[model samples]
Each structure stands twice: as structure tokens, then as C-alpha cells.
Target chain A: MAEIPAALLLLADARLPAGGHAHSGGLEPAVAAHAVTDLADLRDFLHGRLATTGLTGAALAAAACAYAAAYAPDADIPPSGDGSAGGRRGWRGLDAEADARTPSPAQRRASRAQGRSLARAARATWSHPGLDALAAEVRAPHHPLVLGAAAAAAGGTPRQAAAVAAYGAAAGPASAAVRLLGLDPLDVHRVLADLAARMDEVADEAAAAAAGGWDALPAPSAPLLDLLAEAHVRAGLRLFES
Target chain B: MGAHHDHDPHEAAPPAGRALRLGIGGPVGSGKTALTAALCRALRDEYALAVVTNDIYTTEDADFLRRAAVLPDDRITAVRTGCCPHTAIRDDISANLDAVEDLQARHGRLDLVLVESGGDNLTALFSRGLADLQIFVLDAAGGDDVPRKGGPGVAQADLLVINKTDLAPLAGSDVARMERDALRVRGGKPVALTSLRERPDAPEVAAWVRGALRRARGAAAAAP
Candidate 1:
């Protein structure tokens, strides 16, 4: 058993009210497409998501947190504090990388949309220069990157950021699954508990990958999630944003 | 309709930086969307305007506004509530705030912005963070006793609208008792009865909105 940062739990709480409740992270369309029907199918769905999109998102969060934790306010700029100019460039580069990895137009929009909402709440909550840099630099950052920055602002490490990101990737969709499928909430939690060990392994992998710098971060993509996200937007009746 | 002047004087004007936000809220099938469309159509020529619709599962409200063509298509944005309409308008307003800011950025200084809530229960009310003023609608057909059973929506909203007055006779709902009960629970907050069937343009409601805008600007002007 390893010690965890208290802030990590705070960041991972689905009840944080950062507007995440509106997004199903491709679960709605997956349910609609009948790719996820019963609890067993849900188990497979969570596993696949935890591996591909979850891992990639965790790596991005780790990288963003690392960037923020290492922020150095420039001695040169006084009031304007373009002080974060270097960090701004780093955030921009990472955002571009996120864009490159996101294959679907709809998924990209969803990522940015969630990111934008997270930034609004995070900037108010932490008031950190690194968050300022992220906001000043990018039009709209990706969801994982913003989560990582928020995690750092709340005094978390890159690994903790990775853990929270990976947790969100699993937890959000699991919550959505309960609502969409009418599964017993306790049964869903058991499925998530079963994935707990795997979640940690991926978080470790993401933190290690992030240490190799921006380009070395994981870029694993999920084609079905992307396809489903695109389908969800065009859906006439849907309960989720993604 | 402008003669009804029981607004809360303690309600100060919004800060100078943004447009005046008005929230339209009500129970399911309560004619909230109809009121929003009427307001837009009536006021678009009078003021720079835009709207945001908080929809539970779909973009139906936003789509209706677009189809009506009361305002330009770009002026309307729909926010999905993930099934909790009240949360979007009240507890967590990040998405609605973003939509409002985006509309302002794109369209410049809008005199009024309407944030219409997804159909919800009688207890739902917009948070002050989201709307400077709020209108709660109830269908006469829902039940005459709804007004007597005072919830936050019926009691505290800036305006309470009893809609579908034309159906009162067929539905056996008494508009007079509804109004009296509303007056009792509200302690003199304004209430209006509307029949969209006869006045499709919603003249009285539109007039009420005009009076609201006037006060918002008047307070803004009076402030130092």
C-alpha cells in the first residue's frame, strides 16, 4: 500500500462540479450502439477504455502537471508577467500534440469544451501562474492537460496527476454507465474496484513516459471511441455531451 | 403589463462588463420555450439579443429557436444538462457562463441574453450567478393548486407566468384562484397569466421583459 496525496482524491472526486456530469466520454454512444449492454460488456468497455484513451489521457495530464510544477516566473517581466512565457510555449506545444492524437473532429471539440470548463474552475480555485500560462497560450487546452495543471495547482505531483486523469477516464464513464444501463451502482463500483490495480499500473507508465518529455508521452488512440463520439453529436436524442 | 412593478429593489444591476442575463424556467410542458421565442421575436428589433437553451438530452430548444428564425442562427447556443437542468442553471454554471461569454465575444454588446432552462420541476430556480433575473412558468393545465403549493420557483422568481389560460375551461383550472394563490405565496411578487393561443406574440410578457430591461439599465445608470 502506497501513500496518496489528499489532493489526488479531491481531483478524482466525480462530485467536484467541474461540469463533468454533462459528458459521458463516449459511453452514451457506445450504449446506444449496443457495444455495452450488460455488466459484463461494461467490464470489457471499461478495460478497453482504461487501456487506450485512458492511458493516453493520463500521460498528457502527467506532462501538463510536470510543466506546471516546474514553472519559473521570469525576473524580466513585472506587471504583465509574460513571466510564464516559457511555460506558455510548452503548453501550446503539448496542446498541438493532443490535437494531433485526437482523430475525430467531434472528440477534439469535446476535449476542448471540457478543458475550457475545467480551466474556468481551476483558474478560480488555484490562481496559479502555470494555469495562467495555459490559458494565455492556448485557445482551448485539452481536457487531460487542464486536469494535470489543476492537479499541480492543488499541490499534486505528476504521478498523482496521472492517477487522477486515469481515474476520471474510468470513473466518469462508469457513472454514466450506471445511469444509461440501470445497472446496480454497487455492481459498477465492483467493476471499477476490479480495475484498480490496472489503473495504477497505467498511471506509473504515464508518469514514466512523461519524464521522457513531450513527444515521449503515450499517444495510444481508440478508433471506436472516436467514431462513437462523432455519432453522439449527430444523435437526435442523447443524455450526454460526448 | 409594465404597470406591475413589484420588483425587488435590493436586486442591484449587474456589473458593467457584460450583458443583462435573464433566465426562463418552469416545469415540463409549461410553455417556457414559447415565452422565450415570443420574447426574442418581440425584442430582437428593439435590442441586441442572443439566447442559450439548457436542454436535458437534446438540442431541441435551441433547434426550435433556430427554426423560428426570431434571431440569427449563430446567436443561439444550446447547453446539455446531462439530465440535471437545475445544476446547469444553479449549482455549477461553468458551461452556461462559457456559452454566455462566447456569445458576447462573437456578437459584441448584447443588451439582453436569455438563458432558458430545460423543463424541470417546481423547485428549480436559476442561480444569481447565471441570471440577473428569472422568469418561472407554470401551465394552467398542470394544476390550479400548484401556485398554492409554493415552491421556490413560485415564490421567489422575479416573475411567475401561468400559461395556457385558453385551456383553463377545458382543463377545469381556475385562473382567478391561481392568481390569488400566487399573490398570497409570493407576498406581492408579480404574476402574469398568458394564453399563447390568442396572443402568439406574447405582448404582455414582452412588455414585462421590456420593463425588466429598463430597470436593469436604470440601475446601471444610477450606480456610481
Candidate 2:
């Protein structure tokens, strides 16, 4: 096992101002449908989400991290930070992969919106050539790809990027549960604590999956989550972006 | 409104070659939407204007602006606050920034962008990174004591507007006391009192906005 990279904490921190706060990770629509009314229901929903979209997100992040780690220019690069054409093509392909994995158009929009915000925050914070190239190639790259590139920028491994992605997959919804359902914050956090080991396991699987090549990356789609996201868009009242 | 410009020397100058972003924030039902509409109607002829509304639940404010036809649909954008209105404007301003930039992208260059915040409590404020200037609106009906409370919004905002003055007598609120208390805590900042129903144009506030826009343009022109 490798030591944890200190920068992983910053990448995963909710306070990074990357527009993650506005997103509920499908928790809002779940609560609206009465699918998750309490901590127990929320626990089931989180576990289910972790098993599906969480795993897929982690795999995507791992792949993106691996790509950035391999291709990103070092700090000594010129001020222009000209990324190779191959790097830009790689980023665009990964972005298309992310879009393909996201079945729902609404979910795709939410992912891109967050991705754009994360790109701005990452470029400003890390000043990495890979992040700049990704931004240039895909105006709105998916969130997990930016997360992976940010991990690479922060000197983290693919496993670390997967872990951060996996954690956000559950944590974003858990926090939203507290606000939307008015659940006990402590109890909601306890739910996250119980699932911490599961998230790590998913991250481990994701890192292993990334090594299998981009075409072999996991594509675990949550049909119900897709429905919820679509419904969330046309819903009369909505607090979260997704 | 008066000519009392309280420019903080430490405040970062507004970014060059963009609309001067003005934020309007206050408690629920304090007439933020109304003021935004008024400002749009007042200034749209003179300047290229756009709006970004942080409506709590849905695009109510943006919809209202559209229905009122203050500006074209392309000029107005809505940003959901994810249940924490203050966080979108003050803590993590990315969503609002994205909305503003989207508007700019759609319409080339804009002279003004009004980012109306979802109704929040007195402590709510626009991050300096988001709003070049902020106006905290308080209704006379909420309570005259609200100004005396003087939280960050009331005390530190660039301009404070005591709105719904016409309802003061009906609501048994003292407009005089509200103004006095606001001025006391504002440290020489200007305050305006208005009734949107009577003066739909919000002439005094519009005049203040014109002056602020002029100064903002002058400053942006002066910047490197």
C-alpha cells in the first residue's frame, strides 16, 4: 500500500468551491419520490448508488488520472504550456466516454456543468498542463475526468482519484439528505462512516479496472437514477441541480 | 440614495472589460425581484443589461423578469441555490459565476449583470469575487429593528435600501427609525427608501445605479 497523498484531501474537500455543493447526486429526486425518507432508506439508496454510478465514476476517474499522469507536462514547461495533440485527443476521447456512460441527457448536462466548474477551479489551483489541455479540448469535460486530472496534478495515483470519486458519489447525496429531508447530520454522517470500507473496495476495483484500457472501463448504469435525474429536470420545484 | 461612496481601499478592483456585476440580496419577500425588474427597466435603454437570479426552489425570479419583458429571455439566467442560497453567492460562487459567464457568452459584451440572490437572512452577502457591488434590501414591514441589528449585509453592503416604505404606516413600522439605524451602522454608506408599487421605475435607486455604473466603468477603464 502506498502512503496517502496530502493533496488528495484538497481534491476531495467539499469546500474547494468547484460547484459540487449545488448538486445532490440524485438525492433530491429520491427524497421527492419518497424513496428515501429516513436514514435507513438513505443508507439503502447510497449503497445502491455506490454499487452502480459510484463504481463507474471511480473507474472513469482512475482512467483519467492514469492518462494525466502519463501525458501531463511538468512544471518546467513553457508559459504557453502547449500540450501535445495526442494529449488533447486523449482528453476528448475520455470526455466522450464519460458522455456515453451517462445515459440521461439531464445527467450529462449536470456532469458537464460541474466539470466546467471543476476545470476552472483546478486550473486556478494547480496550474497543470494536463488540466489546461483537458479544458481546451473539451469546453465542459465530465466531472470525474477533471477530478482524475486534479488528482494527477496533485501528485496522486489512479487509486487516489478513484477513492475521491467514490467518496464524492456518496458524500454529496448524504449531505443533501441532511438538508432536504432534515435528517440528523450526525446520523447521516454515521451512514457514511458505515460505508467507508465499501467505498474503498469500490475504489480498489476501479483502479484495477482502469488498467484494462479505456474500452474496458466499467459502465454500471443506474436506470432508476437516470429516471430520477430526468424527472428532476421537469419537476415543478427543484433545489438541487442534480 | 446619496453621493456617499464608501470605497474600500483593500477591495480588489472589478475585472476589466466585463459588465459590472451588482448583487441584490435580503430577507424573503423584501422586494429584491421587484428592484431587479425596476433596475432592468430603468437602465436597459442606456446599457447592455443581463440578469442572473438565484431563486431558492425554481426559476421564479427569472421567470418573472421574462414575463415582465424587462429584457430578452437570452439576457436572463437562473441558478438554483441547492437549498443554501447564501452558499451559492457567498461561499461557493461557481454556479453564479457560470451563469454570468454564460450570459456574456450568449450576448457578447454586457454593461450590467444583476445577480439577484435567493432570499436569505441578514448575515448573507455576495462574495467580492462574485459581485462588484452589493445592495442589501430590507422591507419596512420586516421590522425597523432589522437595520438596528446590523448584520454583515446591512452594515457592510455597498448600498442599503429600506424598501416597501408605503407599507410602513400599515405595518406599524417606523421608516425613520429604520433609516436612522441603518445609517448609524453603515458608517457613512448611502441608504435609500422606496416603494416599488408607487414608483415602478425606482428612480432614486436607478440614479444610484447609474452613478455606480459610471464609477465602475471609469475604474475598469483605468485598470491595466
Candidate 3:
């Protein structure tokens, strides 16, 4: 049997203790308010999240990581040593674009939190200077960006990075449903397995986005989800953070 | 709200990376906000301070702090949970974590972050991953028997506070009984009575936080 790399296993382990369990990724509010009820509704929710929020942000993050990693080995990249790669005005532009595209403060906070956590974990577990450099650039890194950078540092391909991002996104909501709706854990696993089986499709979407380059990247649209998120904020009693 | 100024003025400084985040949680009107305000006023000069507040709808708590002029507006950020406050602080803390880092980026020398959860029920408690120390607040107006009910927040918080002692006389609450019951459930962690309206000093609570912050900073410094 071919041996699996330890880094891959470490990155894939859901229980690695990076603190991913607490968030429902906005599903709790959707479920409690009947925005998402059963398997069919959940499938729609996951698909929407994947297409709009998940795909665009995850792809951008992967691309950013790749860009940073590609420039890692150059000794004279720039002595600014500020992790901005020679005061690359272009990087600042990219950061601004990301800030503009993400309208929901709640969503922005969630992405940044996950990014920082992933970066901190990667810094401790891996020996990649590029990942550390990327982490140092921003106070709150976006999750997809950090995940992409971490994957590169860990030697996983962009395809693998997308797979991890997609899986993490899907798994959060499915687990939340299991707890909120009292669905069997076995049933939640089955749903995740089904989603996992389609990783290639998800990865392809992410890769396509990466290939298009950051300037031409497609913007995601899920107005209903955004509206639901806004509504969830005002809800008096809810089980999830939108 | 003070001007939004970066507390750490040094450029490209390495992350200090100290501080243990402690979350303060309780039902609405239970004095979580008041307690947080008190802590900021008490601890700011001694320890580098930052705050993250989860509000269900508006940025009320953050706004309140800013208005009170306890901390700079930038140091106190509001996360509009748009859902359940628990999810942001406990379940999915990505947003809260981001808020913390943003504060750290602007003010890199932080020694403590106080996370305030939206008014929630007894079941609400901070996830261990998000908060090193969790303080659960119960108001005397809620009822004397609340501590005996033994929900997760009541039973598991690092420190449990019976607040609104000033209201206890009018509400006819047994503050001593509540303290005993809380002690019985918490297995000797610690419990304090707070009258935010009267005793702004809140020496006992402040002392507990000072000790917890010291221990948390020590642990962080020791991390490999």
C-alpha cells in the first residue's frame, strides 16, 4: 500500500483541535427559522454557499497563497520585510477588492477568524517561511486565504486546497443540523460522505477560478443567503451565527 | 468613543501573541455588559486591553462602551451575530477571532481580550477554544434559585457572578443562598456578588480577572 503523507493527514483530520466545531457557518439561523429544514433544503443551502461564498473566496485565497509561495525562494524579493513582497501595490489592491466584495460584516469576521486560526496552527505545525510571511501581512487573515497558503506550505496542490475548503464549509453546516435537528450522527456522516464524493467537481470549480487569475475571478451571488444572514442577526433566539 | 487609533504604533512589529481571551456571558439585562464596562475601567491601565462584543441586532454593547469612553472605539468591536450570539462566541468563532486579530493588528501590545456574549440562556457557555476563562452572570432579579438550576453556564463557567445585588433587597432575593448554591454547583471555582449600580469598584471581580489574566499570559509565554 502506498504510504499517505503525514501533512495531508494532519490537514484533513477534523479533530486536529484547530477549533472548527463551534461555527455552523450560518446554518443554525437558517434551520431554526425554517430556512433550511431537511436533507433536501440542506442540499440547496450547501450548494448555494459553495457556489457564491465558498468558491470565490476559497479560490482567491488559494491563488494568493500560490503567489506568495512562488516568491518565497527569492533571496532578494525585497528588504521591506513587511510580508507585502516589495511593497507590492498590487497586493494592497487585491486586499481592497476582497474587502469591497465581502459586504456582510458577520461573514467578513468569520472568514478572518478562521484564516487567523488556520495560519496560527500552520505556523506551529509546518516549516514554511512563505506561510509565515503571508500570516504576518495581515492582522486578521481570511480563512480561505490562510487555508490555501497552509495547503501550499504543507505541499498540497491547489486542487487539494479547494477540496479541504469545500469539505470544511460543508461539514460545519451538516454537523450543526445533526445537533439542532437531532439527526443521527451516522446520518450526518452519510451526508458528508456524499458531499466528499463530489470533491473533484468542487476542486475543478476552484481551480477554474484560480486559472482565471484574481482580476478576472467570478463574483458569487446568493442574495437569499445574505438576506437570511441579516435577518438572523436580529432574531431574538437563535442557535447559529449567520 | 475615542478616536480610532492603533494602540501599538510600531510598524511591522512581530505579534506579541500573549493574552488569554476570557468570555463574559449571561442573559440580557443580567449585567454582562456592565461587568465588562467595569472590568475595562479597572484593568485598562494595568493590562493592555481589547474587547469583542456579540450583539444580536445592533452594535449596542460596543456602542455603549464607546459612549462611556472606557476604551477607544477601535479597541471595542461589535460582531453582529445576525443569528444566535452563542454561535459566534461558542460554535463558530471565526468572526470573533477575526475581531480579536484586527484589534491586535491595530493594537499589537494587547494583554487581555474580553469577549461579551449577547444576552443568552443558561445553556449558553463560551467554547473552551474561544475563551480561556468564562464568566457567567445571573441577576438577582432572575430569581434566587437560578444557580441551583445548574445549566452549562451556571455549572461550568470559570467564575459565576450573581449581579444586581443592589436590586436584591427590592426583589427579595436570597443573595447568600444563591452564592452557596453557585459554589455547590461550581465545585469551588469562585462566585462573587456584583452591584454595578452601587459598587463600581467591584474589587472581588477585578481581582479574579487580574489573577486569571496573569495566569493566562504566563501560559501563552510558555507556549512553544
Among these predictions, the greatest TM-score belongs to: 2
Q: What lDDT, from 0 to 1, does candidate 2 have?
A: 0.89
Which consecutive 10 residues in model 1 chain A have the weakest lDDT in total?
Answer: A75-84
Best-performing candidate as measured by lDDT: 2
Locate the minimum summed-lDDT window of 10 residues in model 2 chain A: A77-86
The CA lDDT at B196 in model 3 is 84
In model 3, state the lDDT of residue B27.
91
Q: Is candidate 1 or candidate 2 better by lDDT?
A: 2
In candidate 1, which residue pairs clash? none
The local distance difference test score of each candidate is: 0.85, 0.89, 0.72
lDDT of 3 by residue, B1-224 (tens): 01111121211211237456879999989998889999999999999899999887567788899999999888899875544677667765666776777787898778888999999888998876678678899999789999999899998887788889888878889988888888778766678888888887677788878766665566556767
Model 3, span A16-105: residue lDDT tens: 445465457878778867888887777777777777777766676656555556645663444232233234443443454466557777
- DockQ-based CAPRI category assigned to the predicted complex of candidate 3: incorrect
Cα error, candidate 2, residue A2 (Å): 2.6
User: Per-residue CA lDDT of candidate 1, range B109-133, in tens?
Assistant: 8999999999999889898988998
Q: Tell me the DockQ of each model, to 2 decimals.
A: 0.64, 0.85, 0.12
Shift in Å, residue B143, candidate 1: 0.9
